[model samples]
Target: MTYTRSEFPDTFLFGLSASDPGDEALTEGFDSFRFPVHWQQVLPRGRGEPDSGGLDHYKHLIDTVLRRGLRPCAILDSSTLPDAIADLGGWRNRDSANWFAHFAETVIEHIGDRLFSAGPAARSWTVGKSDHLGTDLRAHARSLHHHLLATGHAIRAMRSYGMTNLGVEFQLDEPEANTALHAYFHGEYTKDYLAKFSPNLPKNWQRDFDSIDEPIDWCALNYAHFKDLDGSLPWSSLHREDTGETPLYVVADLGSVENTENLLGDIRSDLAQGAPIKGLFAQAQEGECLGLLQTALSGGKQPAPWVAPTKALHGHWNMVADVGGTNTRLGVVTNGHLDELHKFPTGSLEDFQAALRRVRDAVGTDPQAVVAAGAGPLRDGVIQLTNASLTLSRDTLASSTGAQRTFVINDFTAAAWSVADIKAKDVAVLQGSGSPPPGTRLVVGPGTGLGVGALLYSEGHYHTVSGEGGHMGLSPRHRDEVDVFDAARRIAPECFFADSLAIEAEMFLSGTGLPILYQAVCMAGGQSDTPTLSAKDILQAAQSGADEFAVKTARMFTEHLGAITGDLAVALIPVGGVFLLGGVADKNRWLFGQEFLDAFNAGGRFDDIRGGLNLYVSEMDEFGIVGANNFCKNALAR
Candidate 1:
């Protein structure tokens, strides 16, 4: 006689051990169990091309479990992949990202009505070692990027097939899950640090899944032990050595408990001071652990403190765009990491939509959001490009890129946010630097024109402050500067003249301004043989030391820039940090040595104010795109 689901109680027993179906699980008195549906078993080739012989094997296994009154929860992949895809560089390859999606779609198509919940992947963590996902990266940031790429792809693909119940299972303290920044985000990094840290998750693997907005039917913690050296156990032991300053404690006991009293106490301690704990799950054997938890939960008198996890932006790809007058730079941002940077010439593209289409095609998926930083002020959610024949608006941007959320901001505003998540290699310190002192950080640059903004750090949040500060008065200090300012007032084209004898700071500092300074220096020095040079030519000549007039022109520019920087330091009082950005600072970085420092620190009575400020030159070209991405992330999280 064949057994069936009706023969046993609704809560019958079963557990899956390796590939042996549910026979041992049934013997162990477990009601429900999960099993792996290896991708290699279904489509040995990794693509949609199916191997019929391999497909039938998994179908028979599922049918066998059902016949024995066992509930089958299918985990689509145990990080398994076909050899073909693994050979092609696995998850690191953009093409392989879709492999998980294809495999998920195929699995759901075959077992659409059978699964209790369709789980596409398990333990979706990345590190430097070669793992089941076949991705290898020494950097913690890169691993996370590809990890999200694969997860997002599979999630979108599975949902497209109409499978309602989907979830992701994760292990919190897995050894490989704790890489440099990976460990830092998980409330663990250096044990010898001076701060008594807490169990707060600055970053979590769950966010990648949550961002997709796919409902999690269940979360299975692979191993329930929390007493290991790296585990979140004994709650009190999980902290850095205390600094002289008192640190806010955030640790909690996340271990499996036996009785109801201890369990309630453990949870209440975590919620003692409004620290958020979304949900608690027990992963012990069914009798003592499950019964006590069920009884305690059922008999609760007052409502339990229920705090949900951090809500994330929707699970679509996020695109960041930095739009200049001549060209636009676009890249896809996932989990705060940017990749696949591509350039689009605005001259060729008919409109913003044309540029967006090229970006969308390059990404090969619809973006959830697009954060754009354009070289114009954003007014009423729209911006008219200063150098191009395009107007960017949120409404049109969303329609063009198929992004659910769209944000357009001033280019300088975007530059301010880029500093928040800057990499070490991206920054080149010019003067007075260790770590940034805590306060407001300033970003001012000269490209087509002078751009100015500040990043305010208050209450653990970043606020971008920007205005028409670029048009501040240019006060001449030295004789050369006085001559240059006077010459700029006279020879300045009619377009640059604001009023009688009023020379704005940008007239001697910006890309266009650099040439004006060179011509003024030629006039002041009476060098009649000096050829008329463009800003680019002057910069090149100065860098090569080929033209003395060009060298003096560059020097006069820096001296004025340094003095203006000192003035801004006095007004804004950004003791935290100061960033010099754009092509002007980066191209002639050689000029920022002693002469520039001397001029910057020449703030007379307030010389200490400018001298103490940490200064950095941003070498990144697409810093605006980075800022826009962060702006979108923060805005959405809010």
Candidate 2:
């Protein structure tokens, strides 16, 4: 079931839970019913309800989601509906079909208007019976079929009503029907229930149902079986056993991480009976769930041509570094771009040694003609490491000659190669909506460490610019920010940039900048003892306008970012505009849009310079990998 990442689609579902509670606070009741449900817990009663401008909420939510290049799929929950009191088990007063039809209309009226939408359907949700209804196979079966047929009909009806783009999906959705042996032993039902049901199922089920492993589209009955044991046990105990086995220890309630190993164990029985099942809804883990999800979702996204990519001319480089926290691999491209080839680990000297050894072991040559002294810093994070702690290779050298090929170089310089290359891969983020003549581009990365660089776009190609832009002066935008910067300066006054001889610019933009900012805000707000907040905490405080320091920090961070972007804009005249790179650019996009944009466009009379200063929030996570590859491809060829 485990396949390489290469096997998966470029865009696959990476949904994060966002379930919120609705009428009656029925989260516990739904679980009590012994069915899987989406308990999307969100602050301030999740998005879009009737009072929440129902239809408008749906449109805005979906549109905003797709705008980020992520497809949206709604996981409908019983909690979403207005609270109503009804008897347990099929208790909606009106028929279940009528209830769902109403729900479908609310969804389609807004979301279905979009041609690119795939589904607004419920995910892994049951169609019948509350916990008090008890266990009834016939009822479960009848309710499931009824919901599917009704939902399908409702969708067709919606289409008939001119909402042709509406989509409806059904899941088998039964957790009580795991192993026959469990039903026989600990199931709430007596032996008569199984004895009657088994005989009703095809006569061949008992002998071969357990072994059937063919891919079956059981949309009529999306099975959630997660255990595989050939023994008798109570349904409750069996259910616990099935959920307990996991690759990683998980704390789940009703709808939580479990197995998909034997998810559809009994679906074969129904398939053999000529049942028309269409898809599955298993919570995959390890390799099992991945296959089920991929296989079932092979249909892919619809309404093509969603994005447009411009032409990019690649180039080569002399060096590269793997600035990753783990699986670090750096390389020097003596004859090409750093990405196309591998750079030995030179973020640290020991890394340098190991990288050298890897090459020596592979090529069997310790040549000594060119020694350009390649020594990486003996440090990591803010914690300094001795040379002994670093990985060393025998023949790793930045120079062709080994003797003098070991000297200190900026890790940011190595990091810049990839950053600049990423700017080349997708320049639109910086280039803006309409095409601009290729111009110089700026790349700023704020991750575990802050990395900033600029790349020249000339003659339709990118030329990497090497400079310590991040190490420049810490230009505080607000008085509070200035105070915070001064406070941090007190802690490490000697931490100014060296050789680069730049003033500390990271007081508000780097990883080191965050803690300093967070502390200052908390202390100023008189919440200094607020549990030693993280940078994220400070930003959260600002969102609520809780602390002046936090608001100040957020403003300062954005404003400084704007100043940097503006400075780089002037330096490169990046006719192509400016690009905010690294993890920070992507995660804090809202921040960039508000503060950065406000500041970037504040260059006095030169504000017009920002007219085409294409600002973009990159969605590509593999920019480094692909950028490096692109760099390698272009450089090696050159």
Candidate 3:
């Protein structure tokens, strides 16, 4: 059973499993080990005095490990449930999450320095089918929900507590299954089944139960021998079943020297098959476990920091996409920068799947991760495009594009990404004289629809506030605008609803609103000869000075946009500046002429505020795509 630093492959690992509370498992044999601290054992009384005996036990264990130049991998919580908290409805009660977070922080405050990564709760606690009776499914599901929330809170606390090296644990209940139903506990089948099983919890809570699918750090796989009388299945039957391919994985815990060698052999087979085996870990009471993985660690090579948990499976390449009403743009990114760009009409394809394939084909590259921004509302990782037939789902898109992970964000949010570090020359000055100030910035664009978002700089990072600001009520400028608003409401009542005597702005300032405004203007002027035209036609006719109705329509759209811009400036104050995007703003620079500026600057009592605000029209052809790429980079880096 004696192994050395020269016998095993380079990408192997050794670790111990702290099954009990004592330091007996802390002996020298592994590079790392998972030590579980019972909640009640440490606190004894939930929130009372610290158990001195308990504290001394863990301190001695960690100090001994550190003295031996070993890494003590602490597991904050495993199967241990404190009796005090359990009496108070442990995990089921909403307050239990906070209590658990407090415990995690306390541990980090004490022995965090000697640890390889922050101690997070075990995988068995957050995911897996309940071992309790089926009738208690509701409580069990609720417990999972609270544990996930607490996990997120603990991860954030760990980052804030200066624990950069972190790992999240996940393992298939039974790795060998023909379908995803039994293969992975984290799947739609399991989620929907659980939802049906527990209808008592809030619908929204059940719906978003799986939102935390992947962790922010590395994913640790805890595997043990599945055969023999002590284990569940017989070894002959287990080996007969295909466990499928695990391209990139981290082997965390194994018991015996035989199991360690077998798992290492499996990793070696994966490597031979041209599949990546990221790393491995061996766990045992003896030093032989570490000796077995010593050769693997002695190679002095380490896994890349970019490697992520389950979803962000690969660290080599990523993709960024902007799915808008009219166009679908894509690009390949490397090291947080755009490497290639491709574009296609949004409606030219049936759905996001075909569109992604087309873009990938044109670019001639396969990305492991994709960050797509679309113009629609996103729920449960799916987006229903506001103006197109495409429905982009994060899971579906990932499956279609051969990406291990995918993220879908609002299209406006993506466009706002470009505003973070925009140069002066890229924008045409629409109003004001100086550069943007030092506060938040706003990006409002009108195309198929009005897109609105704001950017704020905080904690040395740019945070985007994406919302439906475009649908807010509109305020008319003059008596003529009153008649115009009435006419607009008469034409398209859906766009103009008087809530407390305030009308919606999107129906008057967007591309779809332009045609409606043209019809309204014709009616106001009593010109029956004016023909119905599209927003684009109206703009062309107005620019040619051929149709008076068209001219009026263009004027109305421009002025309304300017008015909304002014209102947004006062509302969000975007001291950084207001960025104008979309085809409408980029195409009609003339429409935003003196009259539009007049309407924008005419803030009445707040005219000084408008006068001090900088206004610029964005001319970036790939603003959203660039933003998407930047967003993926920032997300991965974080």
Give candidate 3's error at residue 551 in angstroms.
Answer: 2.4
The count of backbone overlaps in candidate 1 is 7
| Residues 1-638, model 1: lDDT tens digits | 12222322232222332354544333323333366787788888888677787678777777766665545566666365578876776554556556677787777666745665556543444331247323222233334444444555566565544455565544435544322222322323345321322232224534443333333444333333443334223322222221111121111122333333353454355445332332343343344444444444343232322221232112246888888888888887776778668787766335657878877766555676788888777799888887787787898777787665789898888888878766557778877765565678888898788888888888877888866567787766765466656666666746344664446778778997777778777877776555777888988888899999888888778887887877787788786678899888877788688888888888888888788888888887678887888888888776
Encode model 3's per-residue lDDT on 461-520: one tens digit a residue.
Answer: 888788887788876666776666667676677665554335666776788877777887
- Better model by lDDT, 2 or 3? 3
Whole-model lDDT, model 2? 0.42
- Candidate 3 has which clashing residue pairs, if any? 5-295, 29-287, 29-290
Order the candidate numbers by lDDT, best to worst.
3, 1, 2
Q: Can you list the residue pairs that collide in candidate 1? A: 13-30, 14-25, 14-26, 14-30, 15-25, 211-315, 212-315
lDDT of each: 0.62, 0.42, 0.64
The better candidate by TM-score, 2 or 3, is 3
| TM-scores for all predictions | 0.53, 0.39, 0.54
Ranking by TM-score: 3, 1, 2
Regions of candidate 2 where Cα sits further than 4 Å from its true position: 1-327, 330-395, 398-431, 434-437, 458-461, 479-482, 495-503, 524-531, 540-548, 622-638
Which regions of candidate 1 fall more than 4 Å away from where they truly are?
A: 1-315, 348-351, 361-365, 423-425, 493-500, 527-530, 543-545
